[model samples]
Target: MQVLVCGGTGCTSSASHQLREALRREIKARGLSSRVRVFKTGCFGFCKLGPLVVVYPGQILYCRVGVPDVREMVERHFAGGKVVERLLYREPATGEKKLRLHDVHFFQAQQRVALRHCGLINPEDVTEYIACGGYFALADVLLHQTPAQVIETVKKSGLRGRGGGGFPTGKKWEMAAAAPGAEKYVVCNADEGDPGAFMDRSILEGDPHSVLEAMAIAGYAIGAAEGYIYVRAEYPIAVERLERAIRQAREQGLLGRRLFNTGFDFDIDLRLGAGAFVCGEETALLRSATGQRGEPRPRPPYPAQCGLWGKPTLLNNVETYANVPAIISRGADWFASMGTENSKGTKVFSLAGKIMNTGLIEVPMGTTLRTIVFNIGGGIPHGRKFKAVQTGGPSGGCIPEAGLDTPVDYDSLRRIGSMMGSGGLIVMDESDCMVDIAKFYLQFSQDESCGQCTPCRVGVKRMTEILERITEGKGEMSDLDELADLAREVKDASLCGLGQTAPNPVLSTLQYFRDEYEAHIRDKRCPAGVCRALLDYVIDEEKCVSCGLCAKNCVARAINGEKKGRPYFIDRQKCLKCGVCAAHCPQEAIYTA
Candidate 1:
């Protein structure tokens, strides 16, 4: 029997490493060390109930596994030949235990193309990666195909940039290849700075070799001997794994000079960024990589035309490169057959927010928001009404419940005022105030702006100020029009994608939840009761038992109920709106509106 424990950063922080230690010790104690094997793999994608443990050949996937549970799992499941029914995932709706990985609703709809080897293989072991057909595509490209032929195969596969733009990967490679330069470069953009997005980081942590091979393959296609992976320094696990993978590739003669003795020389270099959100942009990334400030530069000469010290460059994100190996091996038709007509293949998304199952998911490109949120994400938690889902992070938009059924293609999302921005799907519940949500993203955007353009530097700041005033119940109706006008100006005049897509969340929320904005502007009431300045906390007259809990809990002494068996009263002027009374009320009488 083999035991696979989740070693991804998410699970590791949650004592998955301790659990692994306990499992090994337990296996030895049970005298099953010879028979049972243990290996720590990357994310299982079901991160909500982590750290997860999958026992094979039974394939009993146990969730919320602890260090204490390891002994019983080894002794009973391994030796006693019994299943640990308690740890199995219980279906959120049906309340039924699901033992296997595919049986869980969270993973049922996922296709796993880029993430094919993520949770299965040990990232540190090159042999394990090879066993599951890792670098076979690169070998095939080196031995059996020409660079043009390789580019053609990628073109036919319809592989778009998985990094925000969704540009055709083949076309970008071709431009770099055709550019007038003997000295060209291949770049893997791993500086993932999007809030709630972890697709690239997770891929690197799980399968770094896939990226190295893909980069080498790209170098060969684009006629470049060197490649650089610009990753964030914050991702220590990903960096360590990538460094190991690169060393292993070099030691095996997969990289460096004359790979497979085909006279093809390709190697990779790691460039670390200082966690600047603007550095995710190609030009800004190149600048940061070259030891300059992370800022966007004006584009007429795109990266393919002139990049990285004025040389032609082919830049693709980690997720984009991760797909290369699969496309080469599985044939373009197989990959292109799955998704929508234009948007072919699957997209890996970080499922977050109020959803029951918050993890990573890879659905077909045209999969609906409803399918991702409800079917695969196991719906909203606590029976709360689904309000909206914010995709593409701050650069993307808020898709309301009305647009839940809309297919998530590039055109479909674009038509609905959203883009597939690095696949960050943040689910919002009824309790989340759309106005505040807009404000939050706008603030992030304004802070992240590189100040290279007036539209982004001044315009985004002005828009944010307007949003802040609205949240504080000091906004006028005309401020809405002002916001819209400023958003368009900044979007049109910005120098890079960072400034261009910054106002998306604000624009999207304004379009979908206009009433929420009006509630703040006209009524001075936060309908979602989220904006603290506009909220009013009061004790319910009918529900309050006069237990004095509200009065006792109120640090401001705003709740006044001197006598017993009388309803507590909250002084509006003195009340701090801290919700201390509501949280401490035994009768659950206090309410916010």
Candidate 2:
């Protein structure tokens, strides 16, 4: 019996280390150490009920298993063949114990491709990776296929780059290979800077070998002997795992010279980014990797033509590279069969916000937003109405509830004025104010803006100021028109993808929820009551029993009344609108308007 304990970052933070140790101790105590092999593996993706433990051969999944449960698991399940009923995942609605990961609704529709080996193998063990067919693609590419043939196969796969921009992967490799340069380089853009995004980080932590193998394949396809993985310094776990994987691959002759006896030499080096958002851009990343200031330069001298020390370079993000080995192993038709006509295969999304289940999910390209939210995500929490879903993070747009039935594909989302940006899906409930949401995204973009170009620097500032004014109820009718004009100007004049898509949230909100904006501007009233400056707190005299709860909870001494037997009144001037009085009122007398 092999017991696999989740060793992913999320589980690790929740004391999965202690659980692993307890399991080992229990196995030794019961004299089952020889029979039961306890090992630590990567994320199981059912993070809402982690730290998870799965016993192999039977695949009995146990959710929320702590250190105390180890002894029972070793004795009863491992020795007596009796499953732990209490630790198994119970369906929230059906009250059924979900034994396998696939049996759970959260993972029912998921098609794990880029995340293929993520929850299955022990990332630190190269032997486990090899056992799970890790470097077979690289071995096959090196021994049998030419560089041109490899590029042709990728082109046939219809695999567009998964890093925001939907550029063809094969064309990028072909350009770098055909470029007139003796020295070329392959770069893995792991500096994922988008908010609410951890897909790349999860992949790096869970299956570092997949990325290593993919990078080696990219090096071979693009005629590059050396590769650089530009990962952010903030992702310490991912960086550490990637470093360890690289060292292990080198020792095992998978990364160093003459890999797999094909004489196709390739090696990877880690480059730590200083947590700059602009460094996510291809040109800026190239500059940073070369020991220079991270900044974007003009294209046409694109990364394919001149990159990383002025030679041909091929750059692809972590998710895009994660798809490479699978495409080569499973064939292009297999991948292309999964998604829509244009967009092929599954896309991973970090599902966040008001959704009941907030975690990472990989669904097919054509999966509808309705299915993602209602079926897979288990709907919004607190019985609230679905308001909108924001995809693409800061660079993408908000999709309203009315568009829930729309199919989620690259072209469909783009057609609706939103792009499939690195797949950050933030669900919103009815309580979320559209104007406030727009302002929040604008603020994030402005703060993350590199200020390299005048358009992004100045245009985003003006746009943000207008949004702030609108949210604060100081906006005019003219500000709406000005916002649109500025958004277009920035999109046209910006140098890179960041500035170009900075106005997405503003434009999307305006397109979908114009009524909220009009209400804030015309009546000086925030429809959702989220803008504190536009709202006031008042006491409902009928509901107030003079319990003095509100009076006692008022920090500013704003509530004035006789202790327990008289009517309570609020001093408006003294009230700070902190909502403490409202929150603490036992009779629910206080209300905000």
Candidate 3:
């Protein structure tokens, strides 16, 4: 029996290591060492139910397994060959315990492509990665296929860069291969700095070898002998694993000079980047990797043409590289047949915010937003209606509930004013204010801006000021016109993608939830009761217990109730409308309108 314990950052922080030790001790104490192997692996994607434990040959998955549960699981299941009923995942609606992995709702809609070897193989173990056909893609390219043939295969696979830009992966490889440079470079953009975005980080932690192998393959394809993984310094776990994988690959003859005994002297090195969102851009990343300020440079001399110290460079994000090995091994047609006409294969998403099953999920392109939010994500929590789903990080836009049926492809999302930005899908409930959401993202983009360009630096700052004024109930209707005008100017005049797409959240909110904006401006009322300046708090006299709890907790002395079991009155003038009264109201008397 093989027992895989989740070793990803999420599970690791949640005492997965302790559980692994407990399981090992229990197995050893029972003298079941020969039959059972307890080991640490990467993320299972179902992060909400971590640290995940999977038992095979049955592929039985256990969720939220604590250290105390390990011995019982071993004694009952591993030793007695019986399933632990309480540990099994009980369905939310049916309450039926699911013993198998595929039976769970969370894993059902997911089609693991880039994430295939993630939970199944121990990332630290080169042998485990090999067992799952890890280096075979690189070996196949090295031994049989020519550089041109490899590039053609990737192009034919219809795989796009999973980074913010959905550029054709094959076209990028071809450009770098054809670029006039004797000393070219392959760069893996692992600077995943998007808010609520962990697709790249999880991939790196889960399958470091997959990325290394793909980079080797890319280096072979692009006539480059050198590669660099520009990962963020914040991802210490991912960085540590990549370093280990590189060291192991070198020791085992997978990396370094004359790899695979083929005269091709290809190698890779890690460059730690200070967490800069702009560094996610290829040029900025290249600049940062070379110990320069992480700033986006003007294009035309693209990364493929003049990159990484005036040499040709092939840059692909971590998720994009994660797909390379599979494309090489499975053949292009297998992947091309999966998604829509334009978008081929699966996309990994970090499903977060207001969703019931908050975790990492991978769904094929063309899968409806409804499917992701409802079927796969288990819908919104607390029985609240989903207002909108935000994609593409801070630069990406929000898709309203009306567009829930829209396909999650590059073109489809772009048409709806959103981009598949590193696959961060933050679900918003009805209680969330769209105006506030746009302001938050705009603020983040402005703060993270390298300020190299005026449009992003000054234009976005102006737009943020307008949003702030509106949210604070100090705006006229003309402010909306100015906001739209500024959005267009910023999008057109901005230097790089960060600036160009900075207006996405604002534009999307205006497009979908214009009424919310209007209410703030015209009525001086926040429909979602989020904008404090536009919110009104009142006490429901009939339901008020007057226990003085709300009054006691109120920072503004808004509630006035001298005696218990009597109706408490709210002094609207004194009320900050902080919702402290509503939150502390024992009888739920205080209300916001």
How much is 447 displaced in model 2, in angstroms? 0.7
The residue ranges of model 3 lying beyond 4 angstroms of the native Cα positions read none
TM-score, predicted candidate 3 vs. hidden true structure: 0.98
lDDT by residue (1-593, candidate 2, tens digit) is: 78888888788888998999988888888888888888878777776678988888867889888888887887789999989899988877678888876778888888999988887888888999999888999999999999999999899888888889989898988998999977999999999988888889889989999999999999998788999999999888899899999999999999989999877899999999998888888999999998999888889798899999998999999999999999998898898898989888899888888887777789889899999988888898788999999988889999998889889888999988898988888999989998999888888888888888999999999999998898788999999999999999999999998899999999999999998999999999988878888888998888989988888988899899887677799998888878899889888888887
- 445-549, model 1: which lDDT tens digit per residue? 888888888999999999999999999999999999999999999999898998899999988988999999999999999998999999888778998888887
- Alpha-carbon RMSD to native, per candidate: 1.1, 1.5, 1.3
Worst 10 residues of 3 by lDDT: 557-566
- Clashes (N, CA, C under 3 Å) per candidate: 0, 0, 1
The window of 10 residues in a row where model 2 has the poorest summed lDDT is 40-49
lDDT of each: 0.91, 0.89, 0.92
Clashing residue pairs found in predicted model 3: 392-421
Ranking by lDDT: 3, 1, 2
lDDT by residue (1-593, candidate 3, tens digit) is: 99999999999999998989988988999999999999888889888888888899888988889988877898899999998888788877678899899889888888999999888888998999998888999999999999999999999999999997999999999999999869999999999988998999999999999999999999999999999999999999999999999999999999988888899988899999999888888899999999999999999899999999989999999999999999999999999999999999999999999998888999899999999999999898788999999999998998998999999999999998999888999999999999999999999999999999999999999999999999999999999999999999999999999999999999999998999999999999999889998878888888876688888898887777767666878888888777877887778887887
